[model samples]
Target: MPTLLVTASPHRDEALGNRLARQIAARKGGDLLVRDLAAEPLPPLTVDYARALTLRDPLPRSNATLELSERLIEELESTDRLIIATPMHNFGMPAALKLWVDYVLRIHRTFAPTPQGKVGLLAARPTLVIVSSGGFHRAGESKQPNFLTPHLEAVLSTLGIRAPEFVYLEGLVGRRATPEAMIAEAVAVLGDAWY
Candidate 1:
């Protein structure tokens, strides 16, 4: 089964959920692919990119940027298990996540253009999202905790994926907590998932 770990943080070595996913993959005898969006940034959608989209049978132009975008989408379509580890920013996801979404959710690949309505091309799969933030956001508590989780859920659901399992590490600041403690909490919250 294919597994994907999409992360936003610039520092690849510091994500707690990434570390957890690695350990689980090692034990399970599988490969873990971490697509660091920060390292490989997609260009802001341009006229050329739009033109390529309109073509019935498009060919990659000299820029080679469209080729990279297609490769990224292919990887997402193949992955059976997915993990998105992100640090909540401004009560939402970082730009890296948004960029990845822009690439993978392309037409004629991840979705189909239908006369009735938009249809998801992906099969239902399991996804785990681990969110870390300095503040707290409870379902029925905390007036101004964060808006990241809801947005993530909606996007993933639209892609024909199962409801994502969420692990939120809140109050990371001034908690006097160790990284181990935080990871253990995450494991507890998510249980023995695909990791």
Candidate 2:
């Protein structure tokens, strides 16, 4: 499968989610395309851009945001699979990833309005989300809000992607934590889920 791995971890070299995402991609024989969001941060969606999107007006030739938005959407549409590897920052994804999502999930491009409600235009694909959290956020162990998965699932589903398969590397802040154990477990889960 053609896989697009969009990573948002600031510490790309050490992010366990990225490591496990790579393992999953390799196992699936993925023709990998990486979008390093931390290195190349997407601009926030502006009111003008949002207006343009809603009105369906073509931007001028020099509009950088429009150009980038089109490019990102093109990449997403071309891929048959997607993996988003991100660390939990304040119980949500990083700003760069959020900006990327803002750009990609546009009306008339990836989705459309329906009488019942808005519906996705893009074809559904297998999507995976790998998250690394210093604190435990899994069900029953979570004290903090887990806004990341629900937000991502809604946005991805809105764009016609399936509800994502999630892999987590959690409980890294505690003294008893062994990161290696978590990494191994997440990798094993990826293997089972994908293969």
1-195 per-residue lDDT for model 1 (tens digits) = 768788776656576656666665565565667787777766787666667777786656664656677888677777788888788888898888887777767777677778976677788777888787777777664646577888877677656675788887777667658888887877776656553
Q: How many backbone clashes does candidate 2 have?
A: 0
Task: Tell me, by TM-score, which candidate is best.
Answer: 2
Candidate 1 weakest ten by summed lDDT? 21-30
Q: After superposition, how far is residue 79 of candidate 2 from its true place, in Å?
A: 1.3
What TM-score fits each model?
0.84, 0.90
lDDT of 2: 0.83
Candidate 1 ranges beyond 4 A from true positions: 54-63, 113-116, 140-145
Per-residue lDDT tens digits of candidate 2, residues 1-195? Answer: 799999999988577788878877888885899999987777777766876787656565566777789999989888899889998999998888898988999888888888987788888888889888888887798789989999998899889887789888887666255667777777676645575
Instruction: Please report, in order, the local distance difference test score of every candidate based on alpha carbons.
Output: 0.73, 0.83
Angstrom error of the Cα, residue 90, model 2: value is 1.1
